[model samples]
Target: MVALKEALARNGGLWIGCAPEQREAPSNELVMHQRPDFDIGLFELEPPLYRDFYLGYSNSVLWPALHGRVDLIDVKPRYAKAYRDVGRRLARLVAGAVNDDDVIWVHDYQMIPLAHELKALGVKCRIGFFLHIPMPDLQTFKAIPEWQDLARCLSDYDLLGFQTRRDLSHMINIFRNTLRGELRANGTMGISGREVALGSFPISIDVAGFRELAASGADKVSPPPLPRLIGVDRLDYSKGLPQRLAGYEAFLETHPQYRSRVSLLQIAPPTRDDVDAYKAIRSELESLSGHINGRFGTVDWTPVQYIHRALPRTELAVLYRLSRVGLVTPLFDGMNLVAKEFVAAQDERDPGVLVLSQFAGAAEEMPEALIINPHDPHDIAQAIKTALDMPLSERMKRHSALYAHLESHNVTRWSTAFLKQLTSVERIGPDGVAPLPGSTPWSRTA
Candidate 1:
């Protein structure tokens, strides 16, 4: 959402389509609400349509599939129809809102068929799509059975943005093998007469802003003096929260010397509470945290400080600054921004170590982090100990390298790169270059 907002702010003349419930009280509901930077309009769709179609099928099904969780995909006929209906509605809304000069930037899997719908409606704006999550390989993608249709639908967009080279490669491979599309040199593929450009533009954090927050004392909220190790994430299934607690327990058992000397401050804000999986994950995390604290906590100091709420940005920065180790071990993620935030918020004088998950997208860029396999409790335990015992020289070296990377390529840089590529693509002309045929718009299909 931040990325989309930033793009719109830069481009100007933006109409944001969201659920009606979200727009009722826009100030509190919007993520980056009070921006004076650009002319932005918010348009809300009916809640039932958004929830049943967009959130249900798009997020619950396609989101998991893209992130390599084929087991969680639920593709019902009704859900598929709902998905298509929502797309059509979105396209109609966009057609009414947009002008000739406006550039349509579609976000995430929720609106994959949106571009096609807009095209079918004869709205000739240059459209671009970005998938924030990892695009799974052919085998995982094909499990959907409706994969070809979806892929064909996506070809309606002039440019398709992915998080990494791996993601772009996956998409290209799928198009060539499954759909028999002609692959291009610059990560693009031609399918059903439409030319779609595939490219990697990694998501990032506001490094300088985070650094300022860490340095500032204005929003500091000091907790009771405790040797804190931090894990900041949304309480979601993919975050590996239960396994994180188990690893912490194992660490205490194996390295009894550091028992009361350290404590984990797990700042997990609850998300998607309406979803069964998210609710179950929250319950499991709470239970696991309770068990661990029960086993090792004393009256004076609890072994784990579990805070199930989101903190203000500055307060989180302060927490990040105070911590000695930032443990970010997600089972799977596109680009865990928390890892970057933790790195950015560290004190240069006495920098904290970041024990990151190998599977996280940030790990690929910031290899200096103490990478751990979240699936292995033993490995996580060992990584924790290693991070704690790491020498100042080594910590400084890793932190410096990671910080340099973050400073060089921040979120602003990422957004600019994607939008630049998106705008550079030429639309198919009327006479010689025809609009891609045989590609069904999402709204029509729905």
Candidate 2:
């Protein structure tokens, strides 16, 4: 939200997002924090529509498919209808307040169809979209029942943004091969005569914010007797909690000596309890954690501390600082900010090593980290070993690099870069510094 505020500092405006509550709630910044610039609108959905649109289409279908888990997709006609209806309602809600020059930037897969609906109503404002998840492979994307329509709807935007070049390329292929949209330079695409600029704008966290949080007055929970490895994630299947536990288990199995010298602290806060998959994953993780702890844990020391709740930012920061290794091994992620936050929270003199998943978006930015293949338990175990055994000089070097990159491409920069691209699409030339082409002219001026 700070990034959004800073990006729109010159022309302050509000952002809109769907909130699943009893009723529309006031902005937290307005009510709690007493910050005036906190202009976020959260429109509450009808119970039935929320079930269909959010729990059904957005999470059930799009969330899994976009993450390349098409097997989890459960499509229904009503879900799509609900999604479209929500978009229309959202447009109507803000249409009266939106000015002619307002740069409308809809976010994530939920708003994929929004721009198209707005265009249908002849709202000629400059609209942009950013997908916060992976674009999925062509095959996986086709699993969505209204894939073509969804692609066309997204194309209605003046610009589209993904988190990585790989994702951007996959999306480009989708437009060129599936939708038959014209491809152009600089990620600009020509789809049905509309020139849409699409590119990778990797999302990042607020580096200073995390560091400040870490420095805040939060008492350190006395560390366990052994050195710690910390993993914090929502209890989501895609986070590879099972695989991560297995990796640690394998590490202990292979190296019996470390049973007394090291421990794993996994903090998984629950989310999406409405979905059966979430409940199942939680049970499975609990079992796996118990198995690992039982097998290796002594009466004096538990090998794994499995927490099923969220902590305050300050608490998490202290934990990160105390950790000897930061274990973030998501099977697939848009951009795991945990990896960056761990780096930011480290003490410069003796920083903890990051054992990151190669499948994560952070892997691209964190080459110095001990990257591992999440699918291979051996690789993860080995990476953990490497991180733990890494020399102080090497740890400092890796953390320094990681911290610098996080500071450079922080959330503010990310928002500014994407918004700049979104607003400057017309300035692009025939080739280079632009994106793939479209048949339709995006604007009359172009």
Candidate 3:
């Protein structure tokens, strides 16, 4: 959200999305918020339609399938129709607002079919799409009922961006093996007379902004009482929260002397609570945390601190700076920005060690971190022990390497590279001369 908002503020475009406070209304009016640099348009949808489209299809069906949990996908017969209906409605709204030459950049899994719907309405504009989640393997992706339809919808885009090379390769294999698409020499896939370019663009945080947050106001808040290890993530099934808690339990059981000296602080805010899977995970985490605390807590010390709510970013920065280790072990992630943020928030003199998951996309860039297989509680426990006992010199060296990478591949660079590539896609006119994709040629002058 921050990256796209900054991009719109700089490049001058209208940001359109669903309204935050949706009510049961029949009118398709777009509520407008006019900013100095850009405009935001929020459209309304009926309550039932919104429920089926977002909660039912997007979260319950596509979310699990994309995360390689096809067994958990609960797709009703009406879900496919609801998804298509929502896309058609949004396309009509967008076609009415956009110009003929505007470059449309769609984002995430929810809007995969928007470009196809837009083109169906006779809108001849170049549209690009970026998928933020991990693209599943061939058999996993093929398990989805509407795989063919989804692949067809994806081919309508001029370009497709993924978070990692593995994800990009998986997508390319799907196109070549299943769809019989021809891979050209220029790295574009030709299908149904349309050429689509695919690339990996790992998203990043605003490094300078986060560093400012970390550096400012150190005296306002007191430091933690114990040697803390932190894990901050949304309360989702893919985050591996239960396994993380179990790993902490294993660490304490194996290393008895460090029980009172160190603690694991896991901060996970609720997400998609209305879904059954989310509710089950939340219940499981609560039970596991309770069990760990009951088994390890003394009169003066608690081994696990489970916070189920959100905290301010400034407070989080302070926590990250003061902790002894950052435990980010997701089973699979597109790119966990919290790992990068932890690196950015560290003190150079005495930095915290990072225990990351090999399955996360960030592991590709941050090889200096102590990478562990998240599926193994023993591996996570051993890595945590290594991080907690590492010398100050080794910690500083690892943090230095990680922080330098974050500085070079910050969020601004990510957005600039994506938009540059999106605008540079070759589109020939009637006279064989190519122009810029968007109305205003993309420039960095702003």
Candidate 4:
């Protein structure tokens, strides 16, 4: 969202999204903010529509299924219709603002079908779509009753972006299966007899700004009494919070000597509380945290310091700096930015260890960090022990490598690459230029 705002400042556009506090009626309104470079539109939905569109299909069906949990598929006809209805409603609001010359870039699953709707309404501009989350594996995606329709809608875009090569490959394979399109060797597919460019541009944080925040020493929170291992994620099932707590318990059990000397500080703010799955995950996580704390707590110390709230970046940076280890072991993720942010905020003089998940997209980028299976508590526990026991020289080496990569692959580079590609797509217009594909070239502009 920060990068989106910055891009809007550079090249103006409107951002329409859902924000309940901005509720005037069922219609979207332009948000007049301090920054005049861009416009923001917020719409409030009716209760049943909200329940189905957001909490129902988007979360219960698309989200879990996309993240490789097909059993969680809760597809209802109303939910699917609600999804389409919301897309059409959003498209109606967007239609008033867009023109033939403007580039229409849609984002994520909720807005997947918006481009097709816009095209149907005769908005003849180049449309691009980027999925921020991981694409589902072929079989898991097939579980969705409307998978074929969704895949067909995806092919309507000129270009598609994924966070990792794996995700792109998955999409291409799925397209071959569902769209019956021939997949080319260079990651293009013959979708409706035209080539659609597929590419991966891993997302990143503001590396320099985060490092400066680390340097500022502002908003520093009081570190835990023990040598802390930190886990920062939104409270969600895919984050593997329950497994992490179990791993922490296992770590305490297996390594009794470090029981009082070490602790896990987890900062997980609630997300999608309207959804029952999210609520269930929260309950399971809280139960696990309580059980672990009860099992391994002293009069003056606790084994886990779990904060169910968000923190300012300044404070988070300071916390990242102070911790001895970063535990970013999500069960599934497109790209875990917290892993990079932790590395970026580390003190090189006495850097911390990062225990990352092999399943996370960031794992592909940073091989130096200790990687483990997020599903296995034993594996997570073992990785924790390894991180806890890793030498200073090794820690410094890993941190330096991860930091160097983040410095080059920061968020600015990501946004620039996507937009530049979106603009440079092979449109049948006068300026029929194309961007260098495969991966985005790293940019170092201020």
Candidate 5:
């Protein structure tokens, strides 16, 4: 929504399709709802279709699959029917709202099938679809009962975007091998006379906004009594929260001298509480934190401060600035924005080190980060020690490189680059499809 709002503000004449309930409410970035003469239209769908098709099937089935949790994918005949029905309904809504020249950008796996439905309805607008999560490998993808149908449905889009080259490659490989679709060298797939361009376009944070927040003295609201280590993440199974707690405990055990002087603050906002796996992971994290604090607590100080609630952006920025080290260890993430936010909030005179996970997509771009394997508690512990103990010269060099990269490629740059490429694809019709325009073939090693 943030990206769309920014894009629309720069270039108006956009009509968004959202749930009828949100029609009257204005978005935080744009006052489109308050604009009584706005062309935006909200449509209604049956409650069962919204709940079962979108929330149930799309999130429960496709979400886990894309995130590499093949075990959690549950497919029923009714769910597939519900998915198709909702897709058709959304197609009608989009068709009604769009014109031939309008560029339709669809977000995430929730509306994968909608592109095909839109094409079927003769909506000739250039459709772009961006998948926000990891695309599972072929083996895991094939495990889904309707994988072939899903792949076919996705090919209807003019351009398809993924958070990383690995994700885009995985999708291309699946279509070519599993679905037997023809793949062009440029990552375009041909399925039943339709061509879709596949590309990697990682999402980014609002660098200027965060920098302004940090510069405006909003990041130093209340200084901590002592130097602090912080970890901010959504409470999810993929975040490796238990491992992070274990690592902090290991750090405490390894460096007993710093125990009383340094403390760790973990701010995890709970999400997907309805899912059994998510609930189980949250319980395990709580148990692990309690065990560590019970064993390591002193008369006046606790080794770990765990808060399982959401903090406002300003407060989080303040916490980021106060902390001496930003610990971001996700087991698997498309792109962790919190890592970038932490870097942007730093005071250049005394910037904090970022302990990032190698598995996170952000690590591919921010190589200066102290990358570690989240599965190894010892590695994480040592990284923490190294980050805290590093000399000023070394810290400045790493921070400089990371900060420059982040500033150069802010959210505006990311959105503009993606939409520009998508628009270029639209200008050149399906017949103009070629191998990726300018870059070398994307490789995992690269």
Candidate 6:
């Protein structure tokens, strides 16, 4: 939301959001709210449609499949129907509101069918879709119900964007191999009798803004008494919170000297409390945290601090600055901004080490950091030790390189690059289908 708002603030555009839940069905009109630079259009959906679409199909099915947890998928015939219904309704609202020349950019998995629905409604402006989550491997993605239907909807877009080269490849391969679609001589995919453009535009943080926030908050918040290993994420299965806690436990058991001297603080704000999978993960985390503390914690010294609520971003920046290690080990992630934010919120002279997961999208850009397999507790434990024992000079060198890369590929640059590519795709005419710029024979990246 912040990234989109920032982009629209600079180049004014409309933002659409669903309004607060209401007992009665809302009128077809879209509620309007004016911002300084852009306008927000709010609409309301009937309760059942909202629930089945947002929580049922989007979160229950697509979320699990995208995160590579096929076992967790909850598919119902009604869920898919409601998902399409919501898409069709939103398309009608948008079709009536926007002009034919306006560019429409749909975001995330929830609205994958938006472009197809809009096209059906004869809304001819160019449409682009960007997935903010990982595109699972072919087998895992195929596990989702109505997988082919989703793929067809995706191919209707003028351009499709992903967060990493790996994700882009997974998607294109799915289209070609599974859908039996052909790759054109020129780089576009010939699917459903139309061509589609694809690219990987890795998203990024507002580096300078985050750095200043950390610096400003440093004096307001007190530093930890002992060396602190901080992990901040939403309480979700994909975050690997249980694995992280188990790793911390292994660290304490393997190195008894630091048992009471060091601490691991995990801040996981709750999300999707209504989902069974989310509830299960929360219960597991609570049990794991309790077990770790009971095993190693003392009356005076706590080994693990588990926080279930969120902290203000300013305060989080302060905590990041004071921590000795920033441990981000997600099972799978599109682009974990917390890892980048931790790097941004550091004291460069005696900077904290970032022990990141190899599976995280951020790891592709930040190779200087200590990367470990998130699935292995022993690997995470050893990586933590290495990060803590690293020399000050080495820490400074790694931090410098990481910070430099962040500055070069900051969020502003990320948004600008994506918009530029979308514009180029639009110029290819009404269909907005052309060979991706700088296309390779089999693979492509932007």
What's the lDDT of the predicted structure labeled candidate 2? Answer: 0.80
RMSD of 2: 5.1
TM-score, structure 3 vs. true: 0.94
Count: clashes, candidate 5: 2
Could you tell me every candidate's TM-score relative to the true structure? 0.91, 0.91, 0.94, 0.92, 0.88, 0.94
Inter-residue clash pairs, candidate 5: 186-435, 186-436
Candidate of highest lDDT: 6
Quality of model 4 by C-alpha lDDT: 0.81
Put down candidate 3 lDDT per residue, 170-234, tens digits, no spaces: 89988876667788898888764557788899999888788878878455767788889999999
In model 4, where do residues sit more than 4 Å from their true spots? 22-25, 28-34, 218-224, 428-446
RMSD of each: 3.6, 5.1, 5.9, 6.5, 6.4, 5.0
Q: Over the stretch 210-319, how does candidate 5's per-residue lDDT look in tens digits?
A: 87777676534767887899999888877878888889889988988887888889989988777677788888988988888898888988878899999888778878
Model 3 misplaced regions, further than 4 Å: 428-446
lDDT of each: 0.79, 0.80, 0.84, 0.81, 0.78, 0.86
Which lDDT value does model 6 have at 443? 21
Per residue, candidate 2 scores C-alpha lDDT tens digits across 90-118 of 77666654776778888888878677667
Instruction: Give candidate 4's root-mean-square deviation (CA, Å).
Output: 6.5
Show where candidate 2 strays beyond 4 Å: 1-11, 23-35, 217-224, 427-446
**lDDT (C-alpha) at residue 110 in model 4:** 82
Writing each residue's lDDT as its tens digit, candidate 6 over 1-446 gives 67777787878899998887754668788889897899999888888888888899999999999999999999888888888887888999999988878888899999998887787778878788999999988888899867767777787788899989889889988987655667766657776456678888888878899999999889777788899999999999999899999898889889898888888889999999999999999999999999998888889988889999999998899899999999999999998999999999998988999999998988989999999998899999999999999999999999999999999998888788878877776233445433222222112110
